[model samples]
Target: MLTDAQLLAAAARFGTPLYVYDAAELDAALARVRTAFTDTRLFYAMKANPNLTLLARMRAAGVGFECVSAGELARAVKVGAGGSDILVNGPAKSDEEYAEGARLGATFIVDRAEEVGLLPPRSRVLVRVNPALEVSTHDHLATGAGGSKFGVPLGGVPAVLNALRAAGHDGRGLHVHIGSAIRDATDFAAAFARLSELRPAVGELEVLDVGGGWSLDADLDGIADQARRAAQVFGAQLWAEPGRYLVAGAGVLLSQVVGLKATAHEFVLLDAGMTELIRPMLYGAVHPVLPLWPRSEAALHNTGTYDLAGPACESGDVLAREVPLPRPQRGDVLALLEAGAYGAAMSSNYLTRPRPAEVLWDGEWRVIRQRESVETIWAAET
Candidate 1:
């Protein structure tokens, strides 16, 4: 939990539309998960928030990493993660990524039959099985459900395994990820039960990669119970790649109100837009937006609903719709809560807006990522 003063100070020093991450909060989230899943091997999905500072902290906490690309693998290595401590998972891995994974001795979560052929001889691999389990989440985030491009279908797992064996790769495990932002433990349990039914075909599983999709407010105890059950049924080591669960609440995006519009519906415009934080616009996701400074009694009592919007040209750049807030004045800062997950990771520079700076606050504040300059943004152009 960041204080309003702290947020204001950060915004003042680093400039508006900045990202602030609480290191203590991140460690606490990790602790909570560890306490719940005592025996499960936890892997931090780097895609959630890949700031090097955060990665270094995760490494210090003894958590392994789940890398989805060559760039992520390099980040893991840069953060001092051992080759064996990394797990490579992605549907569109390049030839270079496979060779790099082989070089790093990382476990590969094979999403397709061809992926197995790409692995090094006798390399450790886990077949990602798409069980087509429907999870209570956004349709676009659903991965294990039918028609998803994430994993090999359950019926296709055997063939993938055979191909792995033929390629001299060690096919020793199974992986399943229903979707992102999963809110129910039963969904995970059901997927695990389905995996149990396929045990006969998978054979002697050594690892069960129960992939990550946990919501920010998901029930950890229930998830732990079901994960334990899955471990028992499969007789294998339990593994989870938690991305959002470990980091979502540890961050906040700080934006300052630039202007106000007296439209049919009141609009509070901010300097931050889709380029700085895209979740709200991209997935229609809702993030709690609160004024940094306390409002007056009269302002709070006489509040009206306003559409909180950004500076982007797109009409979809609205962050919150018809949300009741005390009247916001220009230059007032707002904090977008629960933004530690996909917030910064999925940000883009659309409209040529430079990305914002990122600060890590443990006991003190330090800039982790500096605000991008226009020159830096255009440095690659010929």
Candidate 2:
């Protein structure tokens, strides 16, 4: 994590409405996962925060890339990732994505029944198993829920694997991603135990990817122990695709207070809103706030609560609700914590709001991604 002085220096130099990431924190997060799961291969889920520079860093650290689209694959390639270093995943894939995956020799995560025919010849594959177990998290975040359109159901796994082998592809093993932000460790224990039941069905395997959804405060070693048991049952290597867990705590969205409103409810409107960080609105995520601007020692005693609001027409643009603060004023700066993952990747130019710039802190501030210009957003449009 960056110090308050460092965050303020970044805001002063780069202006408000910017993202600041700590290089040391990123390395530490990766180390924590590696230290916990010593024998497993780690793949940083690109959808979380796919900054090219960050991708290059992960690549340099010997981490593979898990991409869901052609663009993400290209980002991996740009960072010098080889074909075998990428995993092409997602249920609804395009022909172009297939072509790109094949051209790169990437492994395909077989999702549904029909994908068997669409895969490239002799491609290595892992059939995704939807555990269909109810885990503790938002419904939208539960990719393995009973009706979620992510992976094939447990029963359908055999058919997909059989079809994959029949199509002359390398049926390496099985994959199960219960969901993201998982709260219950038992959820994983159940999924892994259930997968062990497939021993007679899947037989001995090469890779057992128990997909990552372990919460930030999760018992990683315990979860890893459960995963090891499942992989040992098949005598396979374990793989994890951690998205939010790796980068969420290492980044922050630095925005300034534009004005304060006191109506039906109080709001501290800022330039960064749903356009910059939507996890709050999309997933009911609550991000911690840190005040950066100097507050007088006298007035510091008078603290108040405010809902951090963004500059959007929709009322849902509120980034956080009922946040305690020191009565922020115009031009005051604040940092939205735990925004490294999914914050930038999910940001849109909705209502023509140009995205904020991103900076990385590695003893000094470096701009990884520059702020988007208004013209560029509409330049591609007719």
Candidate 3:
């Protein structure tokens, strides 16, 4: 773990409300995935963090990408992600996006029957099935199983595949996304078994993609266990799309403490609010916070109990509740840990607040992105 002093030095140089990413950590993560699943291909899910600098770093590490939107696909293309290597996936894709991806020659993971009609002739396709497995994570992050709006239900997928086969669509694989931030390996195994039961022949399956939900802060050993199990079961080419597990802990969000307020409960207001990170207020997401000033007893100080709220006007915009942290004072720099995924990408300009800056650190810790100015925000509005 990098010391608070080291992070503070970087924050002081880069300015507050900045995202500092550790490129070495990301590379190490990719290496771990490669080492663990020798037969499996790891595609970094770009929806988690779309910073072009991060994308470029992942590209350099030889990791493929899973793009959700056409813009993300375009970014991947710009960063040298070949269409044949990149996997195009999303719950709801526009016809234009579908055409663009097919025209560009990318592999498309078909999530619905309607998507098949939009595909170009001779396009490669993979069937995305909504396994009836429940994702143990937060409700909002749960993407697989029957209730999710993300994929084609299990019963509907075979028929769609049959229809596509009858139409001569190039259906070459099976894709299943159980959930996001999933911690249980047993759950993953169960989901895989279900997908396997649906499609028996390993020879016919070109790729069996277990959707990207491997979480980092959770039981990575469990994830490895599950991956090993699936590798043994499915001899076909394996693929995984992991977002948070790759980048969550590798990045940090630095914000200035604007003020402190005490009502029925104490609150530490931060300059970077939900406009910068909505996971907290949006899904009751919890992130560890570190205070830069008045460092006293490390044990008593950072026992990690505080309500870190954002500056958004809505009371629901609170970042974390009952979070543990060292005592923070006004103007103090607060480093939010495990903010690499869903941190800056989900930022908005709600309440007219200026979005924060982003920077990437390649072990040496240099600024890769600059802070946004008030003039820049106003210029867009005007």
Candidate 4:
């Protein structure tokens, strides 16, 4: 694991409010999966981290890209991700996006029966089977559960297949993504078994997409094993769309401590708030937090269970609530761990707080994304 000092040095040289990604770690993650599941097509879900550098790296590693929107598809293309090698998903794609995806020669996962007509003749398409399988995770992150605006429900599958047969849609694959940040491999195993059961209905199934959601904070070896099991069960060209698992633990948010306040309660205020890293407040997400430099060398403190917040004026704007870590003082660097995914990408200019830069670490450091300045924010403002 890279030390916080290295990250802080990169931030100090490049400037604070940064999304620093470890390129080596990313390669290691891909290598782990490739080595474990030799026969599986590891699709890097671009929705998690669409940085061209990450995309290009994954592409160079001989992995495919999974996209949900036109912008994501365009980003993959910009990074040499072949259109033919892309998988287009998402339930609410606009006609323009669908046409663009078809024009680019990308494969799409049809989420609705009506959209089957939108695909071109001989179009490479997959049927997204919504098992309505509920997993133990945040509700907002659960997509396959019944009542969510995700893939076609299980009961609707036969109708979809019938529709495909009627419309002459050449469906060549099955796609299922149950949830995000999934900690249990059994959820995936169950979903894979269900897809396997439906294989007979989906003729000549050339692809079986076990969509992304592999959790990074937990033991991922279990995830690897489950992926292998899925490949074995499906017995088709297998695909795993992993987003956070690929980069969550490999990246960190480097924010400088600005002030400490003990008003109604003690708080370690940081310059990075919901504007920079919104996972904590937005989804009530928990990212292991720590100070760059421990306040004492003798022993670690109880972390005081204080809120680590930002300078944003909004009362709801906070990074972590009641997080326990070494009490941080003014000007100390606070490293929010496990923020590689959905951190900087979800950033905003709310409260007019300018976002930070991004850097990539590969033994040596390089500036990947430049920090945003107040002037940069105003440049687009009317």
Candidate 2 regions exceeding 4 Å error are: 295-297
- lDDT string for model 1 (59-176, tens) is 9888999999899999999999866699999999898888898888999898888776567777999899888888888888889888889888888888888888878888878998
Each model's TM-score, in the order given? 0.97, 0.98, 0.92, 0.92
Full-model lDDT for every candidate = 0.87, 0.91, 0.78, 0.78
lDDT of 4 by residue, 167-194 (tens): 7766666788988988887887777777
lDDT of 2 by residue, 1-382 (tens): 7888999989989887888899999999899999889899888899999999899999999999999999999999999996768999999999999999999999899899899998878999999998888889999999988899988888888888988998899999999999999989999999998888888987899999988988888999999999999999999999999989988999999999999999989889998999999999998988899998777886688788889999999888999998888888899899999999989889999999888899999887899999899998999999
Measured over all alpha carbons after superposition, the RMSD of each candidate to the real structure, in angstroms, is 1.2, 1.1, 2.4, 2.2
Q: Which ten residues in a row have the lowest lDDT in candidate 3?
A: 197-206
In terms of lDDT, model 4 sits at: 0.78
Per-residue lDDT of model 3, residues 9-32, tens digit only: 877887778887877777777777
Stretches of model 3 off by over 4 angstroms after superposition: 200-203, 218-235, 298-305, 378-382
* Pairs with backbone N, CA or C atoms under 3 Å apart (clashes), candidate 2: none
